[model samples]
Target: MKLSEGVEAAIHCAALLAGLAPGKTLPAAALADYHGVSASYLVKHLNRLVAAGMLASVPGPHGGYRLGRPATRISLLDIVLAVEGPEPAFRCGEIRQRGPGALEPEAYRKPCGINVAMLRAEQAWRGALRAARLADVIAGYEAEADPRALAFGCAFLERHQRPGSPLSNPE
Candidate 1:
């Protein structure tokens, strides 16, 4: 199934947040710049993440955004849901009940086989996403990404990470 572009941006933003020092945060504009997306577009997704409790939005001059919880606790499914909502990619309209030679309403009481299969596949896909934590993604990135890519990410975080107060709650 095709997911929205926002999902990619949201996942990348989460991974970047995982790299920040404890209590550090990054502004939306900086995140957009790093991801090569518009700040307005990124903010919409960021707001959704905050609403989903996947991200924490801090206020004030030294404030920005940070993880709502540990990276280990946040799954890719969480990010996907935050950006794309919880609806499955496929929806069955029960076309079997429509058109010519359609059976009586009670005759087609059994769920559509095609719908059942699609839902089953969607469940499997969601299960895989649910099993994948943001921490795992970051670990894999650090381990498998190109050296220059790693260096650039590190440099960007070093340069743009805002210093949130030690006592401030990320939420």
Candidate 2:
């Protein structure tokens, strides 16, 4: 199943936040700029992440966003659920009972095999996402990123980061 564009944005933003030093936050504008996305649109997805408890919002001049928990503790599935909700991707419509040759209601008392198989596939997809964590994505990225580039990124983020701000140090 194809995920919405917002899901892709949320995942990338989460990973970027995961790379920040503890207590450091990146403003939504910066996140939008970094990804070349619309700030307002991105904020909608960010809010979803906030509501899901995957990310926390810090309000104020120095306020932006930060992970609500450790990267390792947040799964891809958590982000997916946050952006997409918990509805199963494959919704079974009981198509087996809709046509002219449809089986009698009593004849098909059990769940349709097609429906069951689809549900199983959806479960497997969810399981794969659940097995992945933000930290895993970051680790893989850092492994492949050039050392100079990585250092530059850390420096850039640090320069833009607001420290000791009231919102930055959330209670």
Candidate 3:
């Protein structure tokens, strides 16, 4: 099923935050720059994450964002829900109730077969996402990513990650 771009951004942001040193955070603009997205567009999704307790926001200069909880405790499903919401991907319109042979409400007492099947599929999909922890995503990337690409990300983090202490933040 197709999910919104916000899901991708939220997941990526969480993954990137997974790499942050404790007491460090990344500004929304810096995150947008890393992913080649508009800062404004990315902030809304980031705000959703913050609201969901998946990401924590720190205000003021030298304040940005970091994971609200450990990567090990945050699932891909958490990020997906934070951005895409809890609605099922396939919302059955119950077209079976609309056709020529449509039966009375009492006659069609059972759940629609198509709706049941779609609901089962959605449950499976959500279960899979729930099984995927953000820490595991980081481990997989670190283990399998190209060294050159990894180096670029490492360098970018070094450049943009803001330390929590004002003394550590560059003017």
lDDT to native, each model: 0.90, 0.86, 0.88
Structural similarity to truth (TM-score) of each candidate: 0.95, 0.89, 0.93
Give per-model CA RMSD.
1.5, 2.3, 3.6
| Candidate 2 residue-wise lDDT, 1-171, digit = tens | 789999999999998887677677889888898888999999999999999988888877868888887898889999999999999998888887898998768988888898899999999989999999989988998999899978977776877775524334322
Q: Model 2: residues >4 Å from true position, as ranges? A: 146-152, 164-171
Q: Which stretches of model 3 miss by more than 4 angstroms?
A: 165-171
lDDT string, candidate 3, 1-171, tens digits:
899998998999889977778788899999999999999999999999999988888887878988888898899999999898899999988778888998887887889898899999999999999999999999999999999989999889989998864333211
Cα misplacement distance, residue 101 of candidate 1 (Å): 2.2
At residue 100, candidate 1 shows an lDDT of 100
Q: Global lDDT for candidate 2?
A: 0.86
Give the clash count for each candidate: 0, 0, 0
Residue pairs in candidate 1 whose N, alpha carbon or C atoms collide under 3 angstroms: none
Q: What's the C-alpha lDDT at position 68 in model 1?
A: 84
Lowest-scoring 10 consecutive residues by lDDT in candidate 1?
Answer: 162-171
Q: Which ten residues in a row have the lowest lDDT in candidate 2?
A: 162-171
Q: Candidates ranked by lDDT, best first?
A: 1, 3, 2
